[model samples]
Target: MMLLLTQQAYADDWGCQVMLCMSNPAGPMAVAECVPPMQRLYDAMSRKGFQWPTCDLAGKPDTPKPFKLDARPQVPGNLAPQTTGQ
Candidate 1:
């Protein structure tokens, strides 16, 4: 006998200044839940030193860019794909 496992996926989301960071963690959520989690993701990525399309949420570069979401894997510290986003 064989068993198959299906993967769960979250809705694609974009957050922060510009369409900078995107996330699809776990499964889908209500529209209200998107921003906070996405903000948390940006925080995590910032802590991990992701070196592109950054934003200073506390200060300038406050212009909101048109929202866009890309299905790209989160790559941090220029490490291998197998490495966690940390």
Candidate 2:
């Protein structure tokens, strides 16, 4: 039973991926960076429970250079106020 539980824990591990665009010596470039299986992060922010294939960003990723990162609150998918609808 313990072995099965351990395996289930490992299966729940999630990846942290980010895209960074920067000014390389050659030119502007974008690269994907992943800091995976952030166990401590998982512990702190798993209040709503584990969500697969997605993360609630605690802090925005850094923009390397030559690219501007827009600081704005994203519109919640279905939470937006409807302009029209009886």
List per-prediction Cα lDDT, in the order shown.
0.49, 0.38
What's the residue-level lDDT of 14 in candidate 2? 38
- After superposition on all C-alphas, the RMSD of every candidate to the true structure, in Å, is 18.6, 18.1
Worst 10 residues of 2 by lDDT: 15-24
- Taking all chains together, each candidate's TM-score versus the true structure is 0.22, 0.16
User: Alpha-carbon error at 13 in model 1, in Å?
Assistant: 14
> For residues 1-86, what per-residue lDDT tens digits would candidate 2 score against the true structure?
35543333232323323111122333222332222333344454666764444423424566333346655556777675545564
Cα-lDDT of candidate 1 = 0.49
TM-score of 2: 0.16
Summed over model 2, clashes come to 0
Q: Model 1 TM-score?
A: 0.22
Off by over 4 Å in 1: 1-30, 49-86
lDDT of 1 by residue, 2-50 (tens): 9999854333323342233233334333345455655666676777666
Badly placed stretches (over 4 Å) of model 2 are: 1-37, 47-63, 66-86
